[model samples]
Target: MASTVCGWCGDRTHMTMVTDLYQLPEGLWPTKGYSATPDRDLPVWMAAFRCPNENCQRLSIGWAPLHRAKMGPTKDLFLREQLNWEPTQIRRPAFPDVPKEIADTASEAHACLSIGAARGAVALARAVVEATAKAKGITMHGIAPKIAAMREQDIISPLTEQTSHQIRKDGNSIAHGDIGEELMSLDDAAAILEFMDALLDEVFQRPAKLTRLSERGTQQAPGGSADGATPVQGGADFSTPH
Candidate 1:
């Protein structure tokens, strides 16, 4: 048995065989058994495996077929049905440098997107833009004006402003029940989320990284000479004066 990542425990483990291979009877086959080509032999297999992790010794049912490959034959497991698998809430990306409230709202928007809540996702995305603008001290009557103000202040790029405005418009359509605007689709919601990620990266993450690097350079430079060489501790410079 090859070592594989256990989905339950999130650990590397060798699967333990729990059941014998069971092949379906030929009478149940619909004209053809699992073979892709007539010349190749039919390959059908079913078995159960147990996770080796002591904490998560869950059983999983698997089905596969021996596939003919260009190099040789290979076993391909197409189905992995874990009876003990429990659905977990989707995790959202954490933006540590961003304000806690804004980050949490953005995370909720992402979680909504993951579960096919497109309208809710877009609504929360619009909220994120508003929250971001407010956090940046850009006070305006509407989202569009706030976005434009941000653009004028050079807080965000023109393209970012345009995208944020568009997202706001889309969310407004859903919120106001506009018959003219189509309901938010999954693709549209995903695109909005992507734009939000880019905006947050530009506004928070990149600047934080640059600030940290600047601080580090300043700290390191104190011990270095003007010529970019580190000064020896307790040693006098003996170089000829230029």
Candidate 2:
């Protein structure tokens, strides 16, 4: 099996264990499978895996089915269920070095996603965007205005502003139950959360990385002078050995 991200450990490590495999009886489905054959011919696999992270070596189980295309040269295996046994396990999005409040809200959003609460997840994801904007001092009255302010301040690009507006609109529809707006689906909620992840990277993670690099360069620079005096500009001997 190929390496996959462990839901338990939250790591992309090589860890997969096939516990069982079986083929369903023939004529189980009235429709054709991906191979245009009967669905009963498909192979169902049950697997167990351990997280590779030393701190989180928890076990997880998954079920998947193999599929083959009829007209194309495509064969694929898709996971139907992948879950950790413990309900209280940590499940978080992969945005590192985010502020505590934003991270906490995003974690809740992810939990809601896991439980199929699409509306709740989208609401929390919208909260994450609001918190991020507030952290950056864009405390406008509403999410749309805040996003607009962020774009005005060059905190986000115009494209990102449009996307944020769309996310906020969806979240508002879920909150207010607008008749004309479509209900939030699981995929919709997940997409909003994914956008938040990328936004955090752009606003927080990348800036912090550049700051660290600058500080490191300053710290590693050679001393000013032999007597601890400030070196004059263009006065240092470039040919001298350290």
Candidate 3:
């Protein structure tokens, strides 16, 4: 078996093996599997998998170097080796266990939401997740897909579907065009960010422990700030430690 240092931590994590069977020629399974074994290289057909950190309970997705031939073939690879495997259409991430970071972002998002600024809401929500992931040593790219997969695993509530969809749309707006006038309202942005923060909190920790806006207060629409700026929401005080 072989090992590599986890990107988030210097701790050397041994490779574990996983295998998945794909339909031949027709290309039925778009994704492949990896073994838990650290030494096994990716076969032309298989995808590589590794733990994001030695202490993490979940695994991360990665492609083996093309020249190495260290993994098994994609189609014939066995999935059983993964033990606790979950297939995803896109790459999955290794989120760390950090609640305080998420709480801070949520607080900022709440403040933005209180103001009713769409752009600010979106920007703050993105910042919260990005910062949380960074502190925990996770990546933000493809985070939406990762959340979607987590939903499918029933690790979080199905209600997350709406939040994931909105985030995807928000990302598209930022990348391709303006956030649009409708998105400028603080209330609209706050609601979306609140949902997003809830989702991240669930992903990083226990689902039951996730935040619920309904429990806190009515889902108020953002109004305007003191100087006629966009309406904003109150900062969230997570009385319970994350």
Candidate 4:
């Protein structure tokens, strides 16, 4: 079995437990030879894959037949194909601090890539950028103007501004039914989604986090030094109310 992707963390590898599964010991694997796909005529083996990533030792439960996934000559489409996974791999990471609308659009973009919709992913990524710009109070008429406003206000770096433009162009092309050599692969889609995440972090997530942290500190901080050695609120005793 070749490497597979973990839906939980998007870790791609030969996640198979033992390099060789044909040599299963007795009582190791229960095999009723269940056919998950009747037309394919191949029985799928379901198991928990061993994750090498210590930071994300997530037990990925997956079902696959003994055949390799379909791939281009040199690249993977990140297509679902015949594999069935528990968590479902999408390049989306958690964005708890972003606005609900923006987070939803960003997840939709990544979800498009998970099913091999590179063009759709690119298009939705453009939407995310525009939405982010608007959320930042840059309610301009067009993407170019909105992005320019963001750049002028230092809301986004020059590189990020460029990414926003390219995504906008590609999305425009798709809107007019002419993708025109833009986003030819899933890797391209992944890149756009990364840009989306960066945009969200820069425009929304970071600021929200900073404000939350500031408020929480003010609410929870003891009236003392940083270290716990200092007395808190003059060593107030709460056993009896004053």
Which candidate achieves the best TM-score against the true structure? 4
For residues 131-200, write the lDDT of model 1, one tens digit per residue. Answer: 8889999877888888888888888998888888888888888777773645565567878988888788
lDDT of 4 by residue, 1-242 (tens): 22445566676544554322232233333343573324332334555656677677667555554332443521122223333456657666557887788888888887777655678888898888888888888896988899999999999989889888878887788766875643456566667777777888778777776575555555556654675342335333324321
A best-first ranking of the candidates according to their TM-score comes to 4, 1, 2, 3
User: For model 1, where is the 10-residue window of minimal lDDT?
Assistant: 79-88
RMSD of each: 13.7, 10.9, 19.0, 10.6
Q: Give the TM-score of candidate 4.
A: 0.58
Q: By summed lDDT, which 10 consecutive residues of candidate 4 come out lowest?
A: 73-82
Segments of candidate 4 deviating more than 4 angstroms: 1-9, 12-93, 181-183, 220-222, 226-242
The deviation in Å at residue 204 for candidate 1 is 1.8
Candidate 3 displacement at residue 40 in angstroms: 72
C-alpha displacement of 87 in model 2, angstroms?
8.4
Candidate 4: pairs in clash: 3-13, 3-14
Q: Name the TM-score of candidate 3.
A: 0.36
TM-score of each: 0.57, 0.54, 0.36, 0.58
The total of clashing pairs for model 1 equals 0
lDDT of each: 0.66, 0.63, 0.46, 0.65
